[model samples]
Target: MPTNYYKLNLASLPDGLYNQETDVKEWLALTTTSKGSFPPDSLNRVLRMDSSVELERIIGISLWMVGNVLPFVLPLFILASILSSTGLVLLKAFLTYVAVLASLNKFIFAPMFMKRYKRKQLSNTDIKDNQYLHTERNNQKYNSLQFVWPESVNRPALNDKPVIFTAIPHGAVPLGITCYPVWSKLFNDKLCHWTCAPVVLKLPIVSSFMKHMGYIPAKAKHIVDTLTKKEENVGVVLDGIAGMFRSDKNTEIANIKQRKGIIKIALRAGVPIVPTYGFGHTSLWKIVVDPFGILEALSLKLDISLTPFFGRWGWFLGPPQRVPLCVALGEPVLCPKIDEPTQDDIDKYHSQLLQSYADLFECHKASYGWANKKLVFV
Candidate 1:
């Protein structure tokens, strides 16, 4: 549900009767135009439905369905139908044709969409008026997507420097990326790009959507070139898929002990690296365990996440739990430009990034109500 729907109150109605479609239609009609009349049962349904339920559904569909289920499942389904069905010769041929088209669509379609992605300058009023920013039911403050920095750190230092925001505990999904509207506001709507694994970038519709959201392939060449050629900031998941494999509600882990590529890129690009962490991201969804580690091995091998089953409240493939998302931006670690960075340079800066990220987590965990949470680096 959009944030505005959370404001409505349908009082004095019977219990256990709700219809989202009817209520949304009526709401839209009332708010947007008088062209359509409300359905007869709209009031009754509106009164029965809790705003939280709708919010959960929205979170589930947006995060789980869009980010996880659809992209991986659809292509696998198409390929399985094409290969395993021995009897349907004609159908197999058609499915094969469709698969080719989907693969081709991956390359041709996403760039066209990317070219048309426009950025509009937002005013103070525009940022304040954004309903999504106010959608955090857990917190009344519009700072649902909070960015906390150390008291000693200057805000303009972060604002002026071209940075590589290294986010952690990749969570069930990168919920931080989904909050583009809020974070983009923090950067004054300046376009910031994030790097993603090539596996997801090859899926049909998912690739286009990711491209529109400023995701590029997580290749060293691509990251280096983009940082060198563009004036915008770049974001990288230090833990990447390996970090996601370790994501659990009970145990918070960052698989970044060996991840030194981003540090090298930052040094080469002459940009500062910001150790970014998102609180409440891991609590959003619970991952079902693969006791034998088959899924884990496959995930690491393919460089793509393959959680066989995951959701909130034991609902398989359902929406993640509703929680206010907050990202902490640590003091930027300066990386001087080295046309050809050495092993010693990478090692020194990588240690700094780890310390900076750990410091960020320790300093603000209590403030963000994550006092008991500890970030373990694997």
Candidate 2:
């Protein structure tokens, strides 16, 4: 097994020597838990905080935000900063024109480009297609995020059969999930096909970027054709929109308990269902709760999250959270192919898949310092 990156504390060292007595305790307290799991009592104690973890979140989110929003935010800030001081009114007008053009590119050009890209995407086939250029790399090529998975176990290579990966506990931004395309390479690209939401493909500029990253619409026809193709693997964030609802820290809440349509699809396709979960997924956001259920109502209506959220940058979109996030994959559960699986059949396999999710978390959380996290069915 590849050794994970070590996060040891050099604070309170005995001169140049390391103390074995406090080593284990400090490692557990410092490196293992998510930011949300940090004890609140020590929150204000500046001396007790580790700068490295904080720095990662700040740096990660900064790059992500700059990449996502700089084209729109930077010009306006520059124009506003120099508008009053400028003696050249023509230069100010040019800057204003540039800002408006940027806005048009965001609001107009990008969405159309994405829709055209979607229209041109290739049909599903047994052989994997590189119809679009995706910079997403195999895990071996990605270094920014340390993705750890069980190395000792075998997944019975997805060579001859169709398979589905059911991801759980939809986090705020699912930054962890975004890295999955890179991580899924562990299972071999020949077997993986990503199913993305249609609305995500309708975003101004991001929609084009997402398609280039190999996401196809999650339509019934698309799914059926993909699965029917030899050895093609489908990845689904099975937890529906409700998974975005706020829950207690370290809770295993997933909307999976309420949503089980994947069960029927797997049964019909005769594919094995792989239960995947991300510990510390929710910690990516700072969600504002709505007591009267108004937020969830509006979110459902808009098909977007209503619970206001931000990252370290504390803006509309936050930076990468410093929280430790781990996405773990479990052994696939075989489902019998049925033309029409009754509720009992769906329920039976759903429960089994749910159990596999729980077991997967239990087996790996210790390595991720999430041993105390509960596997909530909700």
Top-lDDT structure, candidate number: 1
For each candidate in turn, the TM-score is 0.66, 0.64
lDDT of 1 by residue, 237-348 (tens): 8787777667554557889999998888889889888788877667666776688988888888988777754555765555565555556667678999998999999999
Candidate 2 has a TM-score of 0.64
Q: For candidate 2, write residues 1-378 as lDDT tens digits.
A: 322222222222222122112232332333332322222222111123334333333443443444444454556666765765553564566457546545654455434434533323333341233332111211101212333333222323554576787787776656545553332344444446567667766766566655655566777667767787545777787875577885685666777786678888888888878777766677766777778989888776755554666775675565544555556666567888898999999999988988878766666666566567777786
Root-mean-square deviation of candidate 1 = 13.2
Note the residue pairs that clash in candidate 1.
60-319
Clashes of each: 1, 4
